[model samples]
Target: MLKVQEIRELIKLIDHSSIEEFTFEHDGSKIKMKKNTGTSVSVVKTVGQPVEIPSAEVVHKPVVQEVPVEKAATVNAEVIQEKVEIESVTDLHKITSPMVGTFYESPTPDTDAYVKVGSKVSKDSIVCIVEAMKLFNEIEAEVEGEIVEVLVKNGQLVEFGQPLFLVKPE
Candidate 1:
């Protein structure tokens, strides 16, 4: 029979470690814990066979609740708005990277960059190129603006929908 303290400790260990799944068995009893990287944490416990203590035998199991990403984003936005007024500044707009890739400002290594800081750009202007899965994807500005802040450095491994630059609307 597993003690409550042992189960709590195992839960803590699972939470702290990067390992997504863990299982342990002792004296014909088994416990499994799994972490869902995409959304939440789910813990599953089962006894291999007939167990002496029914209270210690957990079947099916319960999932741990986590904050949704959308709600988290809303909270972050509210916090950011409280700290700074984004609308008052007409010259600051976010330019997010459309895909996960290596950011390149020029077509080739020997050539000059397509745009620089303070560069005026249009909605169709190609700001940078993101090389993803061996293909170079030209990243264009979605909104007409002037480049204000370049968020990511060149040759950085950017994730999908990551912020690449901040543009000030012209």
Candidate 2:
């Protein structure tokens, strides 16, 4: 039998460590603990007799998937075309979202937009705000330029690395 404090300490250690499973047996008592999608523990006790529980093994069947040759070729072709187009375009500075969040044009709904197309901006100018996890982060221009385009709408969900604006650097 394990003391309450010992069990609590064991649980804390297991939670902090990456060990996914633990099992112990002593005298006529057995304890098994497993951490999967959730954490669970099982205990079995017997007097003057030994109890044996079969160990559970997880088996993941191998998945066999087939991709059509034509589909793969088409995807590669599209990727090449996109790269060519991007390379052919004139050099313009892109302001990309630093994190996944909702884009806001103004600090407050009632305030004027921070930047609009043709608006001049200096490095360190606040061009927009990205609200992520309930925190509003001020996005700086980082480049001295004139706003060429706004790529995202107010309150629109922006993904990490997604372009938010294009600027023509001065």
Candidate 3:
């Protein structure tokens, strides 16, 4: 396996040279790299674990224990950035079922749905009904928001804690 500093130097050398592509192999280890006309270089598939490189639009497993330490740091940074962005946005909240039953969109077959996509709802708004053991239970929104999505279909059987609607809270 190549040292991180060695890999860095090799990458630097590749970037500076006019060579369009290069491949090296030793002691059952291999390194393949290619340069494009654009700023980003393309990484080739390795004989190891799968890696997804969006810039190159290629997927390959990494050579066993060959990926540099920087790869881990880069992945961690991307994940942290994604988490920060998720936290910064107004995330949709889930309205889940309290009991197992069949979901109904309306009180009766002829009536309009109690709530639909884009419908604004209050904490107490009855969004749907759950029928179980001959009992029709009114299920409330429980949160103040606009309904973003209905997760369960009419007459669909739902389990406890199953999300029935996604709400963008006020």
Candidate 4:
């Protein structure tokens, strides 16, 4: 496997050079890179696999410096209030998804939700379930608190360590 710095250097070399495409094969590994008309560069890499798949593109956008205008310097009160609310919530505990799966608030469609905003929960309480690979896994609160927010909706795909709920401690 190529190190991060080596890969970055390769990208830099490709970006600075006039070469439109480059291909490399070694041992059981293969790498192909192509520069397109847009800001994205396509890269295909496979290791000992005889499968053809669409190449993944890496987009590099030029950074633009923002010049502040005197009129725009004035802050909106509503924006300040929203920021304050966000700051306050940052201190609250978060219940994150343990795995990548579909989130379910209830065990069945006909049943009541396991948790909702303002619901009190103990560390062992089942706050929700995550369905992964067709297997339903119950998710615990892991903390004693009141549910302040449900970050994901039913049937929504959740990622590992993704925040599923916000809780305010009792």
Count of steric clashes across candidates, in order? 1, 0, 1, 0
Q: Could you give candidate 4's per-residue lDDT for residues 28-96 as a string of tens digits? A: 444556775332323333333343323544333222222333223244444545545855876689999
Model 2 pairs in collision: none
Candidate with the larger TM-score of 1 and 2:
2
Pairs of residues at least 3 apart in sequence or in different chains that clash in candidate 1: 91-168
Q: What global local distance difference test value does model 4 have?
A: 0.74
**Global local distance difference test of model 1:** 0.73
The TM-score leader among the candidates is 4
lDDT of 1 by residue, 98-134 (tens): 8877898899999988888889999999999999999
Instruction: Write one digit per residue (lDDT tens) for candidate 3, span 1-170.
Output: 56657878998998875456778776555677777433232344456544444355544545433343335456555655654564466688889999988899999999999999999999999999999999999999889999877877898888899889988899
Error of 3 at 6 (Å): 62
Distance (Å) between predicted and true CA of 92, model 3? 1.1
Which wins on lDDT, candidate 1 or candidate 4?
4
Error of 1 at 103 (Å): 0.7
* Alpha-carbon deviation at 74 in model 3, angstroms: 31
Shift of residue 8 alpha carbon in model 2, Å: 51
For every candidate in turn, the CA RMSD to the true structure comes to: 10.5, 14.4, 16.5, 13.5
Q: Write the per-residue lDDT of candidate 2 for residues 1-170, one digit (tens) a residue.
A: 56657868988888765466787777756556666421122333333443333334332222223343334556565655664565466877899999998899999999999999999999999999999999999999999989887878898888899898888888
Error of 3 at 30 (Å): 38
